[model samples]
Each structure stands twice: as structure tokens, then as C-alpha cells.
Target: MLLKEIKDIFYKELGDIYPKEEVNSFFYACIEHYLKLERFILAIQPGLTLTKEEEQPLFEALSQLKLEKPLQYILGTAHFMDLELSVNENVLIPRPETEELVQWILADCQEKKQFKLDAERSRSVISTPLNDRSLQILDIGTGSGCIAIALAKHLPNAKVFALDVSEKALKVAQKNAESNKVDVTLLKHDILDPELDPGLDFDIIVSNPPYVRELEKEEIKKNVKDFEPSTALFVSDEDPLLFYKAIMDFSKRHLKENGRLYFEINQYLGKETEALFKAHNFSEIELRKDIFGNDRMLKAIKK
Candidate 1:
């Protein structure tokens, strides 16, 4: 069948759940990836055809999309910063909001030079830097290793490490590091435990942890609650800030003096998160909104 003919059926299949315009956009984007053709070129060359084998995969992906599987998972790869990462059911799909978090951290690093070392608390807040060798960073609850790999790729001088409690998530993270051709130390670690390795000290620490409450699960869209890893998506209703509090405790012991910490937080808990940090004596706390004007990222300096 011709490309135009296929797209007509595509909209018909996905239009009920997705907007007509969005389905068309996804259709063109998928075709462009598979055929290596631009939208205009694909439009001009209607005669270009897929072989039977290729056609099978295309339709298979289309069918999956109709079922609401994310396109990034269907494609098995996603673009983040300057790197392309392999993605699958084993990990949480990278979202644009997380991409914004990455950008904010990068920009924040640029804004600060040296970090003060807090030996008493074993944490450091980012400040002006003296040299490249001193740069250190850690990513907590790294699902697909997106944040760690991206940081390693972008900041070549920084020593990067990623920690996740789930072994399955760590596997995906390891694969992402390999796929991106960057080295990251992936640790199987639960931040709440007191036995955390004591030697690690980071100038900058970032996390996108499970903050969605169990009570809120009913509110999430069907596609997400059904397919993504649940352990990476949920927190108990009684303790929705569990991860944030635990992470702060972990940072108290593991972070370098004057270390700057960043978190991709639950929008509903922005005020609570800032208060928790302040209660821990963290100063210079700042909350920033994403493009949607929702409180999404928080940063603080250890005092």
C-alpha cells in the first residue's frame, strides 16, 4: 500500500484516543525514523514503498501505538541532550520535564564555580570551581540511566555515579550507559538505609524519585499506570514525601561540603519539599517551574 493510504488507516485507528493532528504527527515521525525521509520528502515521494518485512514492523508498531504504548518505547530509543538512549519496559521513559531538569542542572553548574566543603555534614554545595578534576556528581533513583549518562556525556570532566535500589532498573541503566558510550557507576542502593557507603561525596546531587502517591494512582492515565514500572512511580499515601526525606538524609551523610542538590519533585509537594530542606538546615533553596508553570524542580545548598 502507498504511504498516504497507510496514514489514512493510521488516523482512523488512533483518532479515538489521540487527536487527529497528533496521530498524524506521530505517524510522520515514526515513518521518518524508519525510512530516513523528511516529511516533505516523504510527501513528495509517495511511490517509495516498504518491503514486506519492514511493513510488518511498521504495522506492528502502529498496532501497539493504538494500544497506547509510548512511541519512545515502541522505537526503543529516545533523544536526550546530545545522546540517544535505549528505552524499554524495564525503565521509566524519559519525559520532557526530566529533560528540563537536566538542562537546569547543567545551567546551574555553569552559574557556580567553587563548592564549599562541609566536612562536618559530609556534603558540599556547588560554588566556583578551582579545576576540572574536582567535579563530582551523583544521580539517585536513576531508572534508564538517562540523567547520569547525559551528565557524563555533557560534562566530560565530572566523575559520575548513578544509584537505584531496583536491580532491574540498574540493568536498564547499565545498558543505557553502554548504549550512550559513557561510563557510569551503577549501584544497587536504597537511600533510606543507614548503611550507605560513607566515602562518597558529591559536589552536585540530582534525583527524580517515586513521589506519586498510592492514592493518586487512580488519577494517572491508563497508559502510564498500566505499562510503566510501578515501583518507580509510587509512594505510600501516608508518606508521599518518603523519597525526598530519605534522599535528604542520604545527602546529609554522602554529600560534600557546600554540595548543591537538585530534585525533580511532585508538583503538589513543592512547598513541603522546600520546608523539609529548610528543616534540615539547607539554605539557598529555590523552586522553579517547568513550561507548564507547575513547580517541578527544587535546588538547595547544604548550610
Candidate 2:
């Protein structure tokens, strides 16, 4: 079958469901993944054709797309911070805003490391050598271990750990950490359990937990609402800060002195979320907007 004909068929089938540009993107991605062809293949070889085997995956993906399945799940892979992660229905697909959150943490780590090096070189303050103890980081609700693996991969000097309530999610996270060649300790622990202690002090504690309230379900897109794991995305409207509150309490016991707490929060409740940190005595509270100009990230420091 002609590749261009399949592309046309994709447009004909998905054009009504998605925008024209998105349809084009889906077709190109399908071709690239299934056929190992570049997006510009059509431009270079306008008469290109596909074998029956090559055509099957593209058609199958198109059928899934028509059913509003996410492309990442259909492909069983997602890219976050230059790392390609395996994903499935058990895990939520990583998003751009989460990438921004990871970037923010990376920038902060680099800046702090440089400062420590400069201070040591100048002999301004006597302190333990940086190598004496590795930086400790814990990622809560690590559905796919995207944040934890990225941090471990980038900050080689940091000891990274990730926690999730779901054993299935932890299995996925463990696989991702291994595939990414990063040492991340995956723990099956529920953050909401007040009595269960993680039993470690972390230099950094971060979470992108369930912040989407029940009242906001209608605001979510069909693909996200229908396909993504609901437990990873939702909270009660009456207590939208349930996870945040529990994490705050956990940080009180688990976060080291002057440690950092980061969260990817719901856009509509930025002020409310920040207030929780303030009430918990976290200093240096900062709420950041994502590329879309939405209040989507927050950072605070343990006093």
C-alpha cells in the first residue's frame, strides 16, 4: 500500500476527532514508529510504499486513536527530559508541565552544586565535603518514575528514591529506572498513611500527586479522563489538598533541615496550595507558571 494513501486515510478518519495539524502529527508519528521512516520521507520519496506487515501497525494505531487512546500508551513509550520511558494504562503519560518541573529541579541542583564548589574553593566556610554524603531525594507518587529516574540520571551524586501506593505502578517505575540505567529505590508506601514512616531524611521531597478535584472532571479532556489512570489524577473536591496535606506531614518527619519540597499542582489552586506550605512553616515558597501561563509548579523549603 502507498504510504501517502494511509496518511490520507488517517486524515479522513481522524480529522473530525482532532485538528488537521494533530492528525498530520499522528500520521507522521505512526509512520516513524512503525516503519522507521523520518517525517520528511514523503517529501524525499513521494512514491514510497509499505509492506502488508508495515501497514498493520499504522492501521491499528489509527483505530486506537479513533477511540481516543493516548498516543504514548498506543506506542508504549513516552519521552521526558531526553529520556524515552515505557508507559501503559497502569501509568499516566508524562506531560510537558512535568518536564518543566524536572527542569526547575535540575537548575536548582546545578546552581547549588556550583555554589558549594565555589564556597569550598574560597575556604569561606568549614563544612563536610560534598562527597562525604550524597544528596538525598525522594519522589512521592512516582507513577512511572519519570521524575525520580531523570533526577538520578542527571544528578549522579544524588541518592534517589521513589514511593507509590500501587505495587503495579511501582513495578512500572522499577522497570523504567532499570531501563534508564539509573539507581532509584522504589518503595511501595502510601503517603496518606499517617503511621507509616518512610524512615529517611531527604534533601528534596517532590510530588506530582492527585490534585485534580472531582469538580474538575468535566474540565478534563476525553482522552485524559477516559484513558489515564484516575487514581493518579484525582482528589476529592471537598478536600482537594488531601495528598498535599499528607505529604506536608510526611515531610515534617522525613525532610532534612532546610530541605526542599516541590510539587506540580493544579493550576486553579496555586494560592491555596502555597498557603498550605506557608501554614506548615515552609519558607521560600514560590509558585511558578508553566509555559501555558498557568500556575502549575510550586517550591518551598523546610524551616
Candidate 3:
């Protein structure tokens, strides 16, 4: 069939399910992934024809999209921090808000390094250099290793580690780490397990833990609610702060003096999350919003 023919079918079938522009974008993205063509190649070469093998997979992906399956999952990849990551039902699709979370951490870490350098230069203490001082970071419940791998890539002086309860999730994260070409130590850890304590020290501890309460499931989209792994997305309604509390307690035990803690929190519980840090004697707490102006990121210092 002609390239324009498939494009027309994409618009006709998916326009109602997705916005017109989104359908157009998805059509192009699928073509790029499956057919090895650039985004506008079809438009430029209007007479392009797809062989049977190429048409089969593209049509299958379109059918999945009509059922509201996420395009990222159907494509088996998601872009995060300018890196293409493999994603499947085993791991949650990386979101833009999580990308914002990563940017915040990177900015703070880089700024802190600069300030330290400036202070040394002012004091004429040339003996210690930035490269000599290494940072250690631990990411809890790293779904697809997005945060940990991004940190490792950007923070050249940092040693990064990731912990996840599900071995399946960790397997996916491990592939992402290798694909990103960043060194990240993956550990099988259940943060909620009372017997397991993070005994190691870290300069930075971060998490985008399971914060969605059961009551909030109704608010989630069908694509996320039905297709994504529930264990990575939910907490009991009766104890919505379960993971935060555990991480805070764990931070107290494991975070080095003045070490920072970061979380990508639920927008509705910004104050409550901050208060949890305060109750645990954590200081310098700040709750910040995402690009959409929702309170989605929090940072605290263990003093």
C-alpha cells in the first residue's frame, strides 16, 4: 500500500482516540521505528510502498493504539533525558515529570560542586580538587533505571546504585543501564520489607516511589491503569505515605551527614511529604513544582 494510504488510516482510526496531532506524530514515530524512515519521508516520497513484513507490524501497532495501549510500550522504547530506553510491561514508561525531577537533581549537584570549587579558590586551598571528591547516589525503587542512569551519565564523579523490589523491574533497569553505557549497581531490595535496611551510606538518596493511593486509581488513565504494573504505581489508601516514611527512616540510617534526599512526590501531598521529612529531623526541606506547576518534587537534607 502507498505511504499516504497508511497515514490516512492512522488519522481515520486513531483521531477519535487520540488528538489529531498526536496521531500524526505517532504515525511518523512508528514509521521511523519499524520502517527505518525519517518522520517526513513518507510525505516527501508520496509514492513509497511498504512490503508485507513492514505493513504487518505497523498495522498491529495501530490496533494496539486504538485500544489505548501506550505508544511507548507498543514501540518498546521511551525517550528520557535524551536517551532512548527499552520499556515493556515489566517497567513503567518514563514520564516528562520524572525527567524534570532528574534535571532538578542535576542542577543542584552541579551548582553545589561549583560552589565548593569557588570556596576553595577563595580560601587558597588548592590541595583539594573537585575530581578528588566523589559523590555517591542511591535510587530507591528505580522502575526503569531512568533516574539512576541519568545521574551516572551527568555526574561523572558520582557512583550510582539502584534498588528495586521486583526482579523483573530490576532486569529491565539493568538493560537500560547497559544501553545508556553508565555504571549503575542494581540491587534486589524491597523498601517495605522490615528486615531489610539500607546499611550503606550515600551522599544523595532519591526515589520516585509508589505513591498512588488505591483511591486515586480511578483518576489514572486506562492506558496506565490497565497496562502498567500496579506494584510499581500503588500504595494502600489506608497508608498512602508508606514508602515515603520507609525511605525517610532508611535515609536517617544510611544518608551521610548533610547528605541530600530527593523524591518525586504526588502533587496532592506536597505539604504532607515535607512534614514527614521534618518529623524525621531532616532540615532544609523544599517542595517544588514540576513544569506543569504541580508540586511534584521534594528535596531535604539530613543534618
Candidate 4:
């Protein structure tokens, strides 16, 4: 079958449901994944054709797109930072905002390493080199191990641990960790459980926890609201900061002195979320805007 025909079929089927540009993106992504063809294949070879086997998956993907399934889920993969991760209904697709959160942590790590190196060079006695000292980092509610694995991959000296309440989600995270070639200790423990212990203090504790209030469900698109796991995306409207509160308590018990805490937060509740840090023993509270100019990431240091 002609590849262009399939692209036209995708537009005919999904044009109403998604924007024309988005439909084009979906079509191109499907072709790239299923056929290993570049997006410009049509421009270069306008008469390119697909075998029956190649046509099947594209049509199947189109059928799923018509139902508004997320392209990442349909493809069973998502890209976070430099890692391509396995994803499904068991895990929330890693978002660009989350990538920004990871990049923030990485930038801080790099800056600290550089500062330490400079300080050691000026000192007569150097006790320990920053490269030799391993940073202990933990990711709470690690849906697909995206944050934890990315940190471990970048900071090879750091020992990274990931915790998730759902066993299925942990499985996905473990798979992602192994496939990404990063060693992340996966713990299946609910952060909300007050008695549960992760058993290690961390230099950094991070979570992109469920901060979406139940009241905001209406604002979410159908693909997210209907297909993504609700448990991974929502909190009670009455207590929208439930996970943050629990993570704060957990950090108190498990964070090293001056350890940092980071979170990818709900844009609508930036101040409220930052207040959780202020009321506690945290300092240097900073709320950051994502590319969309919405307050979506927060960082604080444990005092």
C-alpha cells in the first residue's frame, strides 16, 4: 500500500479528534516507529510503498488513535531526557515538564560538583573529592523510573532508589531501569503509609507525585482522563497536597542534613505547595515555570 494513502487515512480518521498538525505528528511517529521511515520519506520518495506487514501496524495504530489513545501508550515507549522508556497504562507517560525537573536536578548536581572541585583546589587538605563521594538520591512515586534512571545514568557515582505504591508500576519502572542500563533500586512502598520506611537517607529526594486535584479532572483531555491511570494523576480535592504532605514527612525521616527535595507540581497550586515546604524544616524554596510558563516544578532544601 502507498504510505501517503495511509497518511491520508490517518487524517481522515483523526482530523476531527486532533489538530491537523497533531494528526501529522501522529502519522509521522507511526511511520517512524513501525516502518523505520523518516518523516521526510514522503517528500524524498513520494511513491514510497509499504509491504502488507508494514501496513498492518500503521492501520492498527490509526484505529487506536481514533479512540484517542495516547501515541506513547500505543507505541509502548516514551522518551525522557536521553532515555527511551517503556510505558503503559500502569505508568503515566513522562512529560516534558518532568524532563525539566530532571534537568534542574542535573544542573544543580553539575554546579555543586564544579563548586566542590574549585573549593578543593584552593584548600591545602582535600578530604574527599566530589567525584569519589556518591550522592544518594531517591525518587518517590516513581511511575516508570524516568527520574531515577535518568539521574543514575547521568551521575554514575550516585546510588539511585525508586519507590512506587503500585507493584505493577514498579515492574514497569524496573523494566525501564534495566533497559536504560541504570541501576535503580526499586522499592514497592506507598509513600502515604506513615510507618513504611525506605531504609536509607538520601542527599536528594524527588517526586512527581499525583498533584492533580479531583476537581481539575474536567480540564484534562479525554486521552489523559480516560486512558492514563487515575491513581497516578489525582488527589482528593479536599486534600490536594496529600502526597506532598506525606513526602514531606518521609523526607524528614529519610533526608540527610541539607538534603534537597524536588517535585513536579500542579501549576494551579504552586503557592499552596510551596507553603508545605515553608511550614516545615525546608528552606531555599523555589517554584519554577515550565516552558508553558506555568508554575510546575518546585525545589526546597531540608534545614
Answer with 2 or 4, whichever has the higher lDDT.
2
Give the better candidate number (1 or 4) by lDDT.
4
Expressed as tens digits, the lDDT of each residue in 107-207 for candidate 4 is 99888878878888898575465551478999999998999999999998788899998999999998998898878898988889999876689899999
Show the lowest summed lDDT stretch of 10 residues, model 4: 124-133
RMSD of 3: 1.6
Q: State every prediction's TM-score relative to the real structure.
A: 0.90, 0.97, 0.96, 0.96
**Over 4 Å off, model 2:** 129-133
Please list the residue runs of candidate 1 whose C-alpha ends up more than 4 Å from where it truly belongs after superposition.
114-128
lDDT of candidate 3 over 1-303, digit per residue (tens): 888899999999998888998998999899989988998786588899888888999899999999999999999999998888999998999999999888988888778768778988699656455441378899999989999998888885688999998898999999999998989999898887766765679989999998998999999999999999998899998888999998887887889999989999989889999988888898999999998999999999998
Clashes of 2: 0
The 10-residue segment with the lowest total lDDT in model 2:
125-134
Residue 88, model 3, lDDT: 94
Please report how far candidate 2 places residue 273 from its true position, in Å: 1.0
* 10 residues in a row with least lDDT, candidate 3: 124-133
Clashing pairs in 3: none
Cα error of candidate 2 at position 154, Å = 0.5
Candidate 4, TM-score vs. the true structure?
A: 0.96
- Candidate 1, after superposition: displacement of residue 285 in Å? 0.9
The number of clashing residue pairs in each candidate reads 19, 0, 0, 0
